[model samples]
Target: MTWTIRPPRAEDHDMLAEIYLSVRRQTFVWVDPGKFHHEDFAAHTNGETILVCEHADGRLAGFLSLWPEDDFIHMLYIRPEFQGLGAGTALLQALPEWPQHKYRLKCLVNNRRAKAFYLSHGFVVTGNGASPEGDYEELSFCPV
Candidate 1:
């Protein structure tokens, strides 16, 4: 199925929040799922640029949020059902300066699948650090 990336509207907030909460609960098994709430989405993404990926049929498939000033991808979460369907790639490619600008993101060290995905997309490990979420690797990507 095809997907389209677009800026999210106010009406999309609740669904996006649910997507964020659900994906996190499913992916971050190390974390206490009870601590994640739908409201966390708005709090975490406040002031960041967010792009939503919508399945051709109009369902919200996933979303990516970034700090434009730092070219930092703070979060990229695709619904479990949409994980391998190209929604993440569509969101990244839709960035305003994608392919030309270097974008960075932190991938939890334990999330091998996500690290592999970013690496396959041209991101390289630049550094490592620890976060409350656990150890993470800083990865950056720029097509060249």
Candidate 2:
């Protein structure tokens, strides 16, 4: 599928929120789904730079948000149906200075898929820590 990456507009928030809530509920089965809320998207990504991926048909496929100051990717969530279709990589590549600068993110230890995805894309585990949700590995992709 073809996808275009663009900065989000106010009108995109509702769908983005839904995508965030649903993907978290689906991916983080250990967490109580009730704890995930639509508003969490806004709260978590506030002040971050976000890039939304839209499919050729106009549906929003996924989004990636990052703290530009630290080159930290805060969140990268794609709708369940859209996973593995290149949206994640596209979003990552769309980031500012991608492949030419170091970028970092944390992935829950239990999320094998996400960890593998990042690793396959050249992210290496740089550190480890615990979050309210679970243990996580800090991963970074450093340009060679």
Candidate 3:
């Protein structure tokens, strides 16, 4: 259950991609997993700051990508089996000098688990809108 958070390396690309794809598939069941590939993940994550959570045995547990320049959190995903083990909270706390600042992210309105997690972690709903995939609620987390 212990995990280490570190910046992802090029060699970890495939494993990270799989973790990302798997979490998306499990959490967002409405998505077509066939439509995604490692290359697509690479393209979408290019230039972003990506952090990977690795278990004591070095297995990939989860990852979080941040666009610091825009003060936005692009993605945060924990493997289905790794949920509720403090990995997600650890990832958020691992960010460099981030907790004291405000950042924004969007979560699908149908994703009640994620919405509740964010709310419990201090993020407040700032607005709501619709996306091609589904309706989404925008949230902002500001440090107290």
Candidate closest to the true structure, highest TM-score: 2
lDDT of 1 by residue, 66-92 (tens): 999999999999998889889999988
Instruction: Tell me the deviation in Å of residue 121 in model 2.
Output: 0.4
Kindly list the per-residue Cα lDDT of model 3 for residues 42-106, writing each as its tens digit: 87788999999998988888899999898788889888888989899989888777689888899
- Model 3 per-residue lDDT at 46: 84
- Residue-level error in angstroms, candidate 1, position 132: 0.8
* Residue lDDT tens for model 2, 1-144: 789999998999999999999999999999988999989999999999999999999999999999999999999999988999999999998988889999999999999999999999999999999998999999999999
Model 1 lDDT-worst window of ten: 92-101
Which clashing pairs does model 1 show?
Answer: none
Please give each candidate's TM-score. Answer: 0.97, 0.98, 0.92
Rate residue 96 of model 2 by lDDT.
80
Give the alpha-carbon lDDT of every model.
Answer: 0.93, 0.95, 0.86
Q: Which stretches in model 3 have alpha-carbon errors above 4 Å?
A: none
Which candidate number would show the highest lDDT if scored against the true structure? 2
| lDDT-superior candidate, 1 or 3 | 1
